[model samples]
Target: DDSLRRFVTFEPRANVAMSVNLLVEPTRSDADAGFIVLQADRAHPMSGSNCICVVTALLESGRVPMSEPETVVRLDTPAGLIVARAACRNGQ
Candidate 1:
Protein backbone atom coordinates (compact mmCIF):
# COMPACT_ATOMS: atom_id res chain seq x y z
CA ASP A 1 0.00 0.00 0.00
CA ASP A 2 1.08 3.55 -0.54
CA SER A 3 0.73 4.29 3.15
CA LEU A 4 3.10 1.50 4.08
CA ARG A 5 5.60 2.58 1.47
CA ARG A 6 5.43 6.11 2.74
CA PHE A 7 5.90 4.95 6.30
CA VAL A 8 9.03 2.98 5.51
CA THR A 9 10.37 5.63 3.22
CA PHE A 10 10.31 8.19 6.02
CA GLU A 11 12.51 6.04 8.24
CA PRO A 12 16.07 7.26 7.73
CA ARG A 13 17.73 4.03 8.77
CA ALA A 14 15.35 1.78 6.84
CA ASN A 15 16.23 1.40 3.18
CA VAL A 16 13.01 1.73 1.23
CA ALA A 17 14.34 -0.45 -1.58
CA MET A 18 15.47 -3.33 0.59
CA SER A 19 13.18 -2.77 3.54
CA VAL A 20 10.27 -5.13 4.13
CA ASN A 21 7.14 -4.48 6.14
CA LEU A 22 6.21 -7.31 8.45
CA LEU A 23 2.61 -7.53 9.58
CA VAL A 24 2.40 -9.55 12.77
CA GLU A 25 -0.84 -10.73 14.28
CA PRO A 26 -2.38 -13.32 16.56
CA THR A 27 -3.12 -16.67 15.05
CA ARG A 28 -4.67 -20.04 15.81
CA SER A 29 -3.89 -21.97 18.99
CA ASP A 30 -1.35 -24.07 17.12
CA ALA A 31 0.86 -21.18 16.07
CA ASP A 32 2.54 -18.58 18.22
CA ALA A 33 2.06 -15.77 15.74
CA GLY A 34 1.30 -14.99 12.09
CA PHE A 35 3.16 -12.67 9.74
CA ILE A 36 2.96 -11.33 6.19
CA VAL A 37 6.01 -9.89 4.49
CA LEU A 38 5.42 -6.87 2.28
CA GLN A 39 8.05 -5.26 0.11
CA ALA A 40 8.09 -1.86 -1.53
CA ASP A 41 6.52 -3.00 -4.79
CA ARG A 42 5.02 -6.37 -3.91
CA ALA A 43 4.68 -9.07 -1.34
CA HIS A 44 7.97 -10.90 -0.88
CA PRO A 45 8.63 -14.54 -0.21
CA MET A 46 9.56 -16.03 3.12
CA SER A 47 12.83 -14.65 4.34
CA GLY A 48 15.17 -16.51 6.68
CA SER A 49 16.51 -13.33 8.18
CA ASN A 50 13.01 -12.00 8.73
CA CYS A 51 12.00 -15.22 10.40
CA ILE A 52 14.97 -15.11 12.72
CA CYS A 53 14.34 -11.47 13.48
CA VAL A 54 10.67 -12.09 14.25
CA VAL A 55 11.43 -15.09 16.42
CA THR A 56 14.12 -13.23 18.30
CA ALA A 57 11.91 -10.21 18.76
CA LEU A 58 9.01 -12.29 20.00
CA LEU A 59 11.19 -14.12 22.54
CA GLU A 60 13.23 -11.12 23.67
CA SER A 61 10.23 -8.84 24.02
CA GLY A 62 8.46 -11.39 26.25
CA ARG A 63 5.64 -11.78 23.74
CA VAL A 64 6.51 -15.46 23.71
CA PRO A 65 7.76 -17.08 26.90
CA MET A 66 11.43 -17.98 26.88
CA SER A 67 12.57 -21.33 28.14
CA GLU A 68 16.10 -22.35 28.87
CA PRO A 69 17.91 -24.83 26.67
CA GLU A 70 15.47 -24.61 23.77
CA THR A 71 12.19 -22.96 22.83
CA VAL A 72 9.97 -23.88 19.95
CA VAL A 73 8.44 -20.98 18.05
CA ARG A 74 5.76 -21.63 15.51
CA LEU A 75 5.44 -18.86 12.98
CA ASP A 76 2.53 -18.64 10.56
CA THR A 77 3.84 -17.05 7.40
CA PRO A 78 2.33 -16.57 4.00
CA ALA A 79 4.48 -19.38 2.60
CA GLY A 80 3.49 -21.82 5.36
CA LEU A 81 3.88 -22.67 8.99
CA ILE A 82 7.51 -22.39 10.15
CA VAL A 83 8.80 -24.16 13.20
CA ALA A 84 11.81 -22.41 14.69
CA ARG A 85 13.90 -23.80 17.50
CA ALA A 86 15.64 -21.10 19.46
CA ALA A 87 18.48 -21.75 21.89
CA CYS A 88 18.05 -19.78 25.07
CA ARG A 89 20.30 -19.27 28.08
CA ASN A 90 20.19 -17.02 31.16
CA GLY A 91 17.01 -15.37 29.94
CA GLN A 92 18.76 -14.31 26.77
Candidate 2:
Protein backbone atom coordinates (compact mmCIF):
# COMPACT_ATOMS: atom_id res chain seq x y z
CA ASP A 1 0.00 0.00 0.00
CA ASP A 2 0.98 3.66 -0.32
CA SER A 3 1.68 3.97 3.38
CA LEU A 4 4.05 1.02 3.28
CA ARG A 5 6.14 2.71 0.59
CA ARG A 6 6.23 6.22 2.05
CA PHE A 7 9.44 7.80 3.25
CA VAL A 8 9.68 7.87 7.00
CA THR A 9 12.95 9.37 8.21
CA PHE A 10 16.52 10.09 7.19
CA GLU A 11 18.97 7.65 8.70
CA PRO A 12 22.70 8.21 8.59
CA ARG A 13 25.06 5.30 7.93
CA ALA A 14 26.40 4.06 11.23
CA ASN A 15 29.58 2.69 9.65
CA VAL A 16 30.80 6.22 9.02
CA ALA A 17 31.10 6.68 12.77
CA MET A 18 34.48 4.99 12.50
CA SER A 19 37.33 6.73 10.67
CA VAL A 20 39.26 3.81 9.23
CA ASN A 21 36.21 2.25 7.66
CA LEU A 22 35.83 5.38 5.55
CA LEU A 23 38.09 3.60 3.06
CA VAL A 24 35.62 0.70 3.09
CA GLU A 25 32.59 2.80 2.30
CA PRO A 26 30.76 2.19 -0.96
CA THR A 27 33.08 3.31 -3.77
CA ARG A 28 32.02 6.27 -5.90
CA SER A 29 33.43 7.81 -9.03
CA ASP A 30 33.45 11.41 -10.31
CA ALA A 31 35.47 10.94 -13.51
CA ASP A 32 32.62 12.07 -15.75
CA ALA A 33 33.28 8.77 -17.48
CA GLY A 34 29.58 7.97 -17.86
CA PHE A 35 29.79 4.78 -15.85
CA ILE A 36 29.60 3.27 -12.39
CA VAL A 37 31.44 0.23 -11.11
CA LEU A 38 30.18 -2.04 -8.33
CA GLN A 39 32.21 -4.62 -6.42
CA ALA A 40 30.44 -6.94 -4.03
CA ASP A 41 31.88 -8.70 -1.02
CA ARG A 42 31.22 -12.41 -1.40
CA ALA A 43 31.06 -13.09 2.31
CA HIS A 44 28.70 -10.19 2.82
CA PRO A 45 26.04 -11.35 5.24
CA MET A 46 23.26 -10.66 2.75
CA SER A 47 24.92 -12.45 -0.11
CA GLY A 48 23.79 -15.77 -1.58
CA SER A 49 23.47 -17.38 -5.00
CA ASN A 50 20.18 -15.48 -5.28
CA CYS A 51 21.05 -12.47 -3.12
CA ILE A 52 21.17 -9.02 -4.70
CA CYS A 53 21.80 -5.41 -3.91
CA VAL A 54 20.27 -2.22 -5.21
CA VAL A 55 22.40 0.38 -6.94
CA THR A 56 21.04 3.91 -6.89
CA ALA A 57 21.95 7.21 -8.44
CA LEU A 58 23.20 9.94 -6.19
CA LEU A 59 20.84 12.88 -6.74
CA GLU A 60 23.26 15.68 -5.85
CA SER A 61 25.58 15.00 -8.82
CA GLY A 62 22.97 14.41 -11.49
CA ARG A 63 24.43 11.14 -12.78
CA VAL A 64 22.23 8.65 -14.60
CA PRO A 65 22.28 5.03 -13.38
CA MET A 66 22.01 1.61 -14.98
CA SER A 67 20.99 -1.73 -13.51
CA GLU A 68 20.78 -5.38 -14.50
CA PRO A 69 17.76 -7.49 -13.57
CA GLU A 70 18.19 -10.63 -11.44
CA THR A 71 21.90 -10.71 -11.97
CA VAL A 72 23.65 -13.73 -10.42
CA VAL A 73 26.58 -11.69 -9.10
CA ARG A 74 27.31 -12.85 -5.59
CA LEU A 75 30.36 -15.10 -5.14
CA ASP A 76 31.05 -17.77 -2.57
CA THR A 77 33.45 -15.96 -0.22
CA PRO A 78 34.87 -12.44 0.16
CA ALA A 79 38.03 -13.45 -1.65
CA GLY A 80 37.49 -11.66 -4.95
CA LEU A 81 35.03 -8.88 -5.80
CA ILE A 82 32.52 -8.80 -8.62
CA VAL A 83 32.79 -5.77 -10.87
CA ALA A 84 29.79 -4.32 -12.68
CA ARG A 85 29.53 -1.05 -14.58
CA ALA A 86 26.61 1.35 -15.12
CA ALA A 87 26.50 4.11 -17.71
CA CYS A 88 26.35 7.77 -16.70
CA ARG A 89 26.52 11.23 -18.22
CA ASN A 90 28.14 14.53 -17.25
CA GLY A 91 25.84 16.52 -19.54
CA GLN A 92 28.70 16.54 -22.05
Candidate 3:
Protein backbone atom coordinates (compact mmCIF):
# COMPACT_ATOMS: atom_id res chain seq x y z
CA ASP A 1 0.00 0.00 0.00
CA ASP A 2 2.81 2.36 0.85
CA SER A 3 4.59 1.46 -2.37
CA LEU A 4 1.56 2.62 -4.30
CA ARG A 5 1.72 5.84 -2.39
CA ARG A 6 5.44 6.25 -2.97
CA PHE A 7 5.58 6.79 -6.71
CA VAL A 8 4.27 9.00 -9.47
CA THR A 9 5.42 7.40 -12.69
CA PHE A 10 5.87 9.38 -15.91
CA GLU A 11 7.89 8.80 -19.03
CA PRO A 12 10.67 11.26 -19.63
CA ARG A 13 11.60 9.63 -22.88
CA ALA A 14 9.18 9.88 -25.75
CA ASN A 15 10.23 6.48 -27.08
CA VAL A 16 12.62 4.53 -24.79
CA ALA A 17 10.08 3.73 -22.07
CA MET A 18 11.53 5.43 -19.01
CA SER A 19 10.15 7.68 -16.28
CA VAL A 20 11.13 10.22 -13.61
CA ASN A 21 9.82 11.53 -10.33
CA LEU A 22 9.50 15.08 -9.01
CA LEU A 23 7.59 16.71 -6.20
CA VAL A 24 5.94 20.14 -5.87
CA GLU A 25 3.52 22.02 -3.68
CA PRO A 26 2.21 25.50 -3.01
CA THR A 27 3.69 27.26 0.01
CA ARG A 28 0.78 29.69 0.26
CA SER A 29 -2.51 30.64 -1.24
CA ASP A 30 -2.68 32.95 -4.28
CA ALA A 31 0.46 31.23 -5.47
CA ASP A 32 0.93 30.68 -9.18
CA ALA A 33 2.60 27.26 -8.79
CA GLY A 34 5.92 25.59 -8.18
CA PHE A 35 8.11 22.62 -9.09
CA ILE A 36 10.81 20.28 -7.80
CA VAL A 37 13.17 19.95 -10.72
CA LEU A 38 15.75 17.30 -10.03
CA GLN A 39 19.18 17.55 -11.49
CA ALA A 40 20.00 14.74 -13.88
CA ASP A 41 22.60 12.24 -12.79
CA ARG A 42 23.73 8.73 -13.64
CA ALA A 43 21.43 7.42 -10.88
CA HIS A 44 18.31 9.24 -11.94
CA PRO A 45 15.37 7.49 -13.54
CA MET A 46 14.73 10.02 -16.29
CA SER A 47 18.36 9.86 -17.16
CA GLY A 48 19.89 7.73 -19.94
CA SER A 49 16.81 8.48 -21.99
CA ASN A 50 15.89 10.80 -24.78
CA CYS A 51 14.86 13.72 -22.69
CA ILE A 52 13.16 16.52 -24.52
CA CYS A 53 13.47 18.31 -21.19
CA VAL A 54 9.93 19.51 -21.15
CA VAL A 55 6.91 19.02 -18.91
CA THR A 56 3.39 20.28 -18.55
CA ALA A 57 1.02 20.66 -15.63
CA LEU A 58 -2.69 20.13 -15.26
CA LEU A 59 -4.04 22.07 -12.30
CA GLU A 60 -7.44 21.94 -10.66
CA SER A 61 -8.92 23.73 -7.66
CA GLY A 62 -11.63 22.65 -5.25
CA ARG A 63 -13.99 25.36 -6.48
CA VAL A 64 -12.68 27.70 -9.16
CA PRO A 65 -10.04 27.42 -11.88
CA MET A 66 -8.65 30.85 -11.01
CA SER A 67 -7.15 29.43 -7.85
CA GLU A 68 -5.20 26.86 -9.86
CA PRO A 69 -2.18 26.79 -12.14
CA GLU A 70 -3.89 27.74 -15.33
CA THR A 71 -1.23 29.14 -17.62
CA VAL A 72 2.06 27.44 -18.52
CA VAL A 73 5.10 29.33 -19.70
CA ARG A 74 8.20 27.29 -20.35
CA LEU A 75 11.51 29.12 -20.59
CA ASP A 76 14.19 26.44 -20.58
CA THR A 77 14.62 24.00 -23.38
CA PRO A 78 15.04 23.70 -27.11
CA ALA A 79 11.30 24.07 -27.41
CA GLY A 80 11.46 26.64 -24.68
CA LEU A 81 10.03 24.20 -22.15
CA ILE A 82 11.76 23.15 -19.00
CA VAL A 83 11.98 19.44 -18.50
CA ALA A 84 9.42 18.00 -16.08
CA ARG A 85 10.01 15.08 -13.81
CA ALA A 86 7.16 12.82 -12.89
CA ALA A 87 5.16 13.33 -9.71
CA CYS A 88 5.70 10.40 -7.36
CA ARG A 89 2.81 11.24 -5.08
CA ASN A 90 -0.92 11.59 -5.14
CA GLY A 91 -3.21 14.67 -5.08
CA GLN A 92 -1.20 16.36 -7.87
Candidate with the greatest lDDT versus the true structure? 1
- Once superposed on the true structure, which residue ranges of model 3 sit more than 4 Å away at CA? 1-21, 42-55, 59-92
Task: Give per-model CA RMSD.
Answer: 2.4, 13.4, 11.1
Per-residue CA lDDT of candidate 1, range 1-92, in tens?
Answer: 36775566445745555656475774666889887666555566588888888888889999999999999999888788889999999988
Whole-model alpha-carbon lDDT for candidate 2: 0.25
State the displacement of the C-alpha of residue 87, model 2, in Å, after optimal TM-score superposition.
0.9
Worst 10 residues of 3 by lDDT: 60-69
Q: Rank the candidates by TM-score, best first.
A: 1, 3, 2
Candidate 2 is scored at a TM of: 0.20
Q: Residues 3-87, candidate 2, lDDT per residue (tens digit)?
A: 2112121123222221111013333342222211122211123232212222222222333233333212222222334443433
- For model 2, the superposed segments whose C-alpha errors exceed 4 Å read 1-43, 46-79
Error of 3 at 53 (Å): 8.0
Q: List the residue pairs that clash in candidate 2.
A: 34-88
Encode model 3's per-residue lDDT on 20-62: one tens digit a residue. Answer: 4343343434333333333322123332233323233333232
TM value for model 3: 0.25
Give all TM-scores, in the order shown: 0.78, 0.20, 0.25
Candidate 1: where is the Cα deviation over 4 Å? 9-13
Higher-TM-score candidate among 1 and 2?
1
Which whole-number lDDT from 0 to 100 does residue 7 have in model 1? 63
